[model samples]
Target: MLPPDARMLASQNIVIILCGNKKDLDADREVTFLEASRFAQENELMFLETSALTGENVEEAFVQCARKILNKIESGELDPERMGSGIQYGDAALRQLRSPRRAQPQGTQECGC
Candidate 1:
């Protein structure tokens, strides 16, 4: 179960994803997929496994999360204009998305683990 603070944040419609990282090191895994999946289901979180070494599902994880947030926003479940909602819009956000830099090596990429 999530702690009080986390539950409060979740109550605010914060998008949560349970990401199992370091999938490239599966041989050394301490938890089984069923165990993690069960936990995610109980917690109502989207679940995914990713590998920083191979960049597997890294981008997809973020994209899915973003889509959920956008859906909430569009359905009026979340109000970007509300104080402390932790959502913002405008040209700055678009500009940030458009800014680009040199790409990192795929094997060296690390996403929200």
Candidate 2:
């Protein structure tokens, strides 16, 4: 995950979503639905509760995100023809791949915690 100061992709009319997973497990719940919804509303994010096992709101979350992106594209908010438009690998991913850091094998650790 990127650091706090390294986060700026949400700006410039970008559609953002705040999703909470594992809604199917109500017993182990932490954050309530209303709290999440209120945060989403306050921050202008599409909130969804999804479970990978049951596939609850998984499709809906993706559809809502796609719909927002499409709406922006249709309204000339996002120009795909631009050089830096559309999905591309972020600098962090690129640096990871190009760096000299080799993938560590499972169960092997440099620090024993």
TM-score of model 2 vs. true structure: 0.65
Q: Report the number of the highest-TM-score candidate.
A: 1
User: How many pairs of residues collide in each model?
Assistant: 0, 0
Q: Which stretches of candidate 2 lie over 4 Å from their true place?
A: 1-11, 87-113
Ten contiguous residues minimizing lDDT sum, candidate 2: 1-10
Task: Give lDDT tens digits, candidate 2, residues 8-103.
Answer: 643456677887999889899999999889987876677898998899988888888977865576566776556656543356644332233456
TM-score for every candidate vs. truth?
0.74, 0.65
The TM-score obtained by model 1 is: 0.74
